[model samples]
Target: MVDGGGAIQRTTAQFEGPRERLLCLGPAALRTDELLACIMQSGNGKQSVYEISTKLLQYVGGVYALADIDVAELLSVPGIGRAKALQIAAAVELGRRIVHKPSDQRLQIRTADDAATYVMDRMRYLKKEHFVTLLLDTKHRLIGEDTSSIGSLDASIVHPREVFRFAIRRSASAILCVHNHPSGDPSPSSEDIAVTRRLEEAGRVLGIEVLDHIVIGDGRYVSLRAAGYMDN
Candidate 1:
């Protein structure tokens, strides 16, 4: 009997669990850690790729933050080589672009969520505020999207004359003003409200309807029209 003295015990078969399930199934079935492992491909001989991935996620703050990281920063991780970093960065850019594309032909802006979904991916990643105007034809189809201004975080100046000039040039029947708030809050500020009002009044005189002014945050947004700020 080895009750008092320590004994070397023979190990049984390894228990198959979540981690094994992740490796056996695929990246799609895996958690964030498992997905990172697929990107890493391999790790130092001392640790498995999944173990290395878990440590990297902890260092980077999480998967969401990891998505925002550049190649240089990702390469800084112990197990991530330059090649792996580039692969991850490329995957992120692909995902970002895919989210911005609308699969269907319908261009209707039926709700605030619809407007936000259209602009969030494009604007959220931008470092500076971009004031863009989406010109729509009478059928609510997108004619064009133009960047009116790019400026510092606080605000981007917009002139009604310049805005209408583009609208008239494009022969757009209606317009949707879109701008990003880098602060990641979709709530409209006083200045935001003021700008929307100015654009609405200008559109009234120009015979071009201003359908909405949308403010895009990181993953959220606000539609001035839907909030009853614009007079339809």
Candidate 2:
């Protein structure tokens, strides 16, 4: 790599690939297409990296659509093959891990609001009801969080077994049951209270305490324990 004066213009000697732009100007400087090109490396040789990446984006609609796509769908792009499709899928998964990875400090859920705060960032805007459980240690520190079921329009549809499987396996001392209402109403339905009571009884048998059942809505929540439903 040399310059017009026969001197070493090593940094700028050759073409400006996505990697080089990223190095010189940082990630924020790169456009969406440039970032995709970086992941894609180079084209199938018939087209440039930018062109192929743009075409791929067009085929998939957008980067947002990439989240739900699998290997086979990634291969639908004209110039994309197994290697390219796999690289994209792997990158998406890696990004997802980064986004959802918990904080270094162990999460503690003392109240329903605390538990809601821990999950609201991810669960807030969901299009369907998601029943989730937070497994807690003896100290009430969060050990794990799991989605027990999705599209649960009614609480009765969410069985106690599905909610407690991991808590039993992990030997969790207590658990918090939380679910989002897509309708954005945090008010607890009669069925919600019934399910919570049922789960509390089931937990009593298993030696796991059902601490609270929190129903999430649009920036609001209701705690069954707080409402005197769980005290009985």
Candidate 3:
């Protein structure tokens, strides 16, 4: 896979009675999958619309990865037909248009604060944890950002190989790990510190620097490096 095969896998909270809740509680109550379910409208004979949406998300990896998949690739999934796949591809393109405007030509990550501010809005609002990487070029300019995982923070979930594989492919000189706290606290847990140390060591071996591990919370953030965990 030319995509480097490292997945992003970011998802919103799973929907519980999505369409029903959508009527009673409004769109804010719908998960990302449920919102997509609304777009898909219905599924193939076997799977329910929600199940189809979930399977499509898994096949493409996630919202971030969806932008990379063409309609042909989407048709490979069991429930996604040609028309449905194109519908999804078009929706993904529309979303990519909205949230991922082109980066400024002079984009830079000069400080951990700069890194946190770059991703905080997206991270903070997420209902689950999202482990993301800011891929930076030699001049510390932003090349791309990859979400490595989305869920609770832990070492097992944060695979160094998967994390660095894409960074290496991006020709990134350094990476900044950013993840959110759904509980609204920006403080680092012991697990957070451990993952930072582990990934920092892994980055050293791979010849790519791990600049900082930032924890995003409601309107605030933490830089492990500034807290004496790692250095810039």
Top-scoring candidate (lDDT):
2
Off by over 4 Å in 2: 1-17, 43-85, 99-105, 125-129, 151-157, 181-194, 215-232
Best-to-worst lDDT order: 2, 3, 1
Runs of candidate 1 with Cα error greater than 4 angstroms are 1-23, 44-52, 55-60, 66-81, 99-101, 111-113, 117-135, 143-173, 179-184, 197-209, 216-221, 226-232
TM-score of each: 0.59, 0.67, 0.59
lDDT of 1 by residue, 75-174 (tens): 8987777877887788778887686665577577655576667777667766567888988888777777788888785688888886778889999998
| 10 residues in a row with least lDDT, candidate 1 | 8-17
lDDT of each: 0.77, 0.83, 0.79
Between candidates 1 and 2, the one scoring higher on lDDT is 2
Displacement of the residue 120 alpha carbon in candidate 3, Å: 1.7
Looking at model 2, which ten-residue stretch has the lowest summed lDDT? 7-16
Would you give me the overall lDDT of model 3? 0.79
How high is the lDDT of residue 58 in model 1? 88
What C-alpha lDDT, on a 0 to 100 scale, does residue 213 get in candidate 1? 92
**For residues 37-143, could you state the per-residue lDDT of candidate 2 as single tens digits?**
99889888799889988988888767766764779978878889899898899998898788878889888888778988876766655556788999999999999
Instruction: For candidate 3, write residues 1-232 as lDDT tens digits.
Output: 1245785432344235576567656898688789778878887888998999888778766765564466887889878888888788888778756785766585789988888877765666565677888898888988988888866433226788878989988899988889888777999998889889889889888899988888988899988988998755
